[model samples]
Structures are given as C-alpha cells and as structure tokens.
Target: MGIKGLTKLIGDNAPRAINTNEIHSLFGRKIAIDASMCIYQLLVAVRVGADNLTNDEGEVTSHLNGLFYRTIRLLEIGIKPVYVFDGAPPTMKSGELTKRAEAKKAAEEAAKKAREEGDLEMAEKFSRRVNRVTPAMIDSCKRLVRAMGVPAVEAPCEAEAQCAELVKNGDLFATASEDMDSLTFGTSRLIRYLWAGTASTASKKGIKPTEFALDVVLQDLDLTLPQFIDLCILCGCDYVDGIKGVGVVKALNLIRKHGDLQKVVDTLKKEKSYTVPDPYPVEVLRQMFVEPIVTPAKDVVLKWKRPDVNAIKKLMIEENQFDSAKIENGIKRLLAAKQKTSQVRVDSFFKRATAPNEAERAAKRKAVAETNKKSKKSKTQKSSTSTKGRAAKAKKDVT
Candidate 1:
C-alpha cells in the first residue's frame, strides 16, 4: 500500500540507507509504533485454523490478546512504545482505500470457496488476506495499549505521518512500521521489524529487522526530500494511482533526470509511449506525502504512566476472557521490566535500550556481501556449463 516497490528501489540504489540493528540493541529507546499495522499482524498471528481468537458471543479478540502480550514484551525489554492510531483517510487516498475494500471482498469470496472445497489451508490463506483491522479492533487495541502504560495517540491524519512528526519534535527516536510509508512521510529513522525477535508485517516475507535513515537514504541516492516524494508517487502511493508502466527504477530515473513531476510528465510526452494517470492530481498527491497534516508537534502529548494492573485485568480477563493467571503473569513481567530491564543492567527505565555497534555491524555486512557474491558466482558458472552442454548436444544433432 506504500509506494509500491519502494523497498526494492532503496535496496538497489541506496545501500547506505540500511543499517542492521538487533532487537536487544533497542533496549531503552522510545519508538512510535503504528498500532493498526500491529493489529493486522495479530489477526494473522493469533488465529485458530484461519479464524481469529474470539471471546464468547463471537467477538474477535486476537488483537486484544496480541497487544496485551506484545506491549508487555516491549516494556519488558525497556522500549517505551507510543502506539499511534490512524485518524482519517485523506480525500486523495479514497481511491486506494476503495481498492483495498474490493480486494478484501474478493478474498472473502475466495475463502468461502476454499472452505466449501475442504481446503482448510487455502481457506486460511485467503481469510488472512481478507482480514482487516476494524474500528472495534482499533478501539480495543488502544484500550489495551493504554492499560499497559503505553501512550495511545490517535493521529489527525496518517499514523506514520504523525509518528514522523513525533520524531521531528524529538518526542520519539524513530517510527517502527512494516511499510516504507514512514520514510515517505519523512520519518527521520524508519525501523522495520521492531518486533522481529517476535514479528513485523514484514516477518511474513522473512524480512530482517533493519533501520533506514532518511538523511542517509537521500545522501546515498542523491535525492532531495521533494524528489524522493515525487519518486514515491511515480512508483505509486496510497494517495494517487501511478503511471501504468513506470516502476520504481523508471520513476527513480525520471525524477533524477527531469528534476520534478511536471518535467517528468513533459519528457515522457516527448520521449516514449507511457501511460500516465488522466487526472494525476500531482500537486495534491505530492503535498499529501511532502507535507501531511499531522497533529501539531506541541499539541501532541505522550505520557507513559504506571501500568494500571486492575484496568488491564478487567479488560483481558473480564471483558476479553483471557486466562486470569496469564494476564496477571504479563502484568508481573511489566512490573519487573520497569524495575530493571530483563537482560541488561540499566540505570533508567525510559532510556534503557542500548545503541547499536557500528563497527561490528559493518563487518558482518561485509562478510554477508562476500558470501553472497561467491554464491552468485558459483551459480553463474554452473549455469554456463549447463548452457554449453545443451549447445554441444544441439551441434551433434545438426551433425
């Protein structure tokens, strides 16, 4: 849903954009989490044979279960999490939202067909695709997050954009989300796999938890902030439809060569046959990403209070029907984590996570690159031999 193929584009063009950091290294950092994204993840994770975890009366409670434990886990490790919820979809993003709704409908039908055919596995697969983070789910997640002492903030616009605003205001260090939208929204540091030791939406694709610094990405790709936003739009974003055939690489090249969207459109007109959107809404889409409407930096208040043990218990055990002992155990963990981070000797709770080691990380990256290079070379040699053998056989046939 983020700028399509933006991750791949960054990997290919801006290697310096990425920095590998372990979950343990983030022991005491304040991270702004995309709450709705995590709820969608739980819908996929805490399921019973493709169906969600539900309380009595057929109400979905997987999100509650997931947030309760995951929030505990974050606190246990010394990370101060501020869960940010999406406010309203921008007018420009209505089209993308509509497309997602239709896709969910199609997935629902496909899931039904799979179930009728006795393909439980396929049914579950399609069902996961169909599952959405409903309004009820969002409210429940916020309730659980706040009960755990984490601040739950509802953004005036996109959650990622608000998280970016928080980071810029120095209220938080980074935005932790599965999608590259945080970077597009101008988050200074975008951390994928915040829960990688547990999971991100990226965990489904086996993506490693990595960090992307916007400044580094811009410097490495030689792109201005505006140019980066334009490139994202050309590649397709949630706000506007992209050109039919212009992919990430093409978008990057166009932005690099022409300087802006107007010039890119003019050149595409003269140069080649490319299908641009009819009502491109270039300025509208660009502004949406470039200068998103977020709650004013000062107006947003983030406070991590003491975990309300009784409030958490009432929701998890009474309302949601979670195991009483398990809910209590999680609370104990939250308390223990506050006193002292589980695996580290930290003097303070709020600033517990340790910074990453640059030297060791760079060395490990070099070794990985070398190993991959060797593996690729080996495959190419084997492919060359196979081709030669096929050619020799073809010659003998001719003879």
Candidate 2:
C-alpha cells in the first residue's frame, strides 16, 4: 500500500539508517499519528476468536477500546499524541482505491465461508481484513480525543502527508506511522509500530519500534530527496506500475546510474527486455510525494489540558460499557504523567525546556550509566560467542 517494496529495500541495504529506542526515552515529545491506521489496527486487535468487543446494543466498541487505551498509554508515558485523519483521496489514487475495495470484498466473502465452516480463527483473521474506519468510528474517536484534551488534525488529503508536513514544519517532533511512503513524503522523523499497543509491549516482544530519519537515509543512499522519490516509483508506488523485471534492488541501481526519472525511462527503453508505460505519470507522482496538500502550519493548534473526567466516563461506561476500574486507572496514569513536569503549556506541546534539579539530574545520570554498562556487557558476550564459534569451526576443518 505504501511504496510497495521500499521498507524491505531499506532494511536489506541500509540497516544503519534505522534507529531503535525505548518509549521512556520519548517523554515530553509530541508525535503526529495516522488516525485511520490506528483505528484499523485497534479494530482488528480487539477482535478475539469469534468475539468482537461490543456493547449491550450490539454496536462494535473495538475501535473505541483500542483508541482509548492506546492514547492513554501514550499520555501515561509523557508523550503527547496529535491524531491526523485523512480527507478526500487524490484523483491519481483511484486505481489503488478500487484495488483496496476489491480486496476488502474478497476478504468479506472469505470470512463468511470460514464462519459457515466453523473455522473461528480464520474467520476472525479475515473479518479483521475487512475492517474499515467508518464515519461513526471517526466521530467517536474525535469526541474521545477532545474529551482527553488532545489535538486532532483533519488532513486535506492523506493523513501521512499531513503528519509528514507537521514534522517538517517543526510543529511535531515526529510522525508515527507504519507506512513506508511517509518516508517518501519527506517527514524528517518517522516512528513505526506505535499503534494498537504501547511501545513497551513491542519492546518486550523483541520487536522494538524503529525511528527513521530522512537525513540518515539520504546519507546512506547518497541520493537527493527528489531522486529517492523516483527510486520509489521505479520500485512501485500507489500511483504507478513498476517496470517489468525491476525489483527494489534493480530500481535503486537504475536511479543511482541515472539521476532523473526521464533518464531512468530512457535507460529502460534502451533495454530490449523492458518497456516503460506510455505517458507514465511518473513526474506527477513525484510531485505529489514531494508537495502533498496539507493544512497550513499556522492553522494547527496543539494543546493539552486537564481531561474531562465525567464526559469520558459517560461515553466509556454508560455508552460503551467499558470497565470502570480500567478507565479510572488510565486516567490516573495521565495525571501521573502531568505531575512529572512543572508546567504544561498549550503552545509548546512538542517541546519542554525545563532544567532538571541537581537530585533529578544525578539520578538520571546514574540510570544512563547503568544502561550503558549493561549494553557493553551484552556486546562482549556476543563477541565472545562469535569467537568461540569460529574457533570450533577451525578445529573441525583441521580434523
């Protein structure tokens, strides 16, 4: 859905461009999140076996549960989350839109068949595939977010594009999305896997969230941003078909050899085995990625304030039938995150300049030292194991 093979290409070729860090390290940070992606993730995760989270009226509450809990987790960890929702799709994306709709229809049919066969697990999986973020769900999320005093932005087009814009404009510290195309959108910082669950959960599962910087990737690949976008198009993007026989590796080679899209197309034409699409909208797609429509920087307002407890309780408890104890605990945690800092300001949602007192600074320094010491020990153990394996292999060869 995102630049088709971009993530894999980067993973295999430029591993050092990715950075891994803990949730605790992101305290006092403001991140712009792709709201639709989070909703879809939550809807699927809340569905277990043959049961979907629903209230007494039989309306699905999975989306609400996921959104509420995940947002609370972010707040509890001292991270301010700005949710961004998508608007009208770009005209060029009509083909991709049709493809997604067809896939959803197929998934729905498969789920029905699985249910008829009493295969609950497969049915559940397929059901999740058919999950769509509906208008009602979006409204509910918006209400919940407002009640929690968090900011929500409605993007002019793609949410990822808007999030990237926010990061570029310095309105947000980073953009949080799983989409690889966010990188192509030129977001300075992109954090992956911050949806449906807490970052700590990912860490515990040994699948830590990765933070990607646009500059680092550019440095590693030695390509300008415009050239990188061309490389993505060559690999395959939402708007265009990839050249036949050209995978991510070949695409990168072509881009590296030829600095421009026109040149790349010319090179492909010379090759007897491949053909470029006639009148390919390659330039249009490149421009769309480079200059996506987004809300003006000055129009965005990020503010955090005391949550409306009674309103949140009514929506979750009386309407959605969520556990009172759990909701209360989440609210308590939000309050705890607030108490850690001296001032919570509306204008500076993404920045905190408070200087730590001597005692707090000393404790932080000690904690950092311990962490570094443990890291050193872990590296030493791995090195020792590698040396021992090589020695054993040598002895076997001698024998």
Alpha-carbon lDDT, every model:
0.82, 0.82
Model 1 / residue 145 / CA error / Å: 1.0
Give per-residue lDDT, candidate 2, residue 396. Answer: 100
RMSD (Å) per prediction? 11.4, 12.9
lDDT of 1 by residue, 1-399 (tens): 887999888899888878886576777678999988888878888888889989886899988887877777777767888999999888878888899999999999999999999999999999998887888888878887888777899998899999999998878879999879889888889998775545445446655558988877876676778888888888888877778778889898889888898789776766567867778767887788878989888998888788888998888888888999888888888888766433443544455343234455457667999999999999999999999999999999999
Error of 2 at 124 (Å): 2.1
Against the hidden reference, what TM-scores do the models get? 0.83, 0.82
Roughly what TM-score does model 2 have, to 2 decimal places?
0.82
lDDT of 2: 0.82
Error of 1 at 132 (Å): 2.4
List ranges where model 2 is wrong by over 4 Å: 196-203, 270-272, 341-399
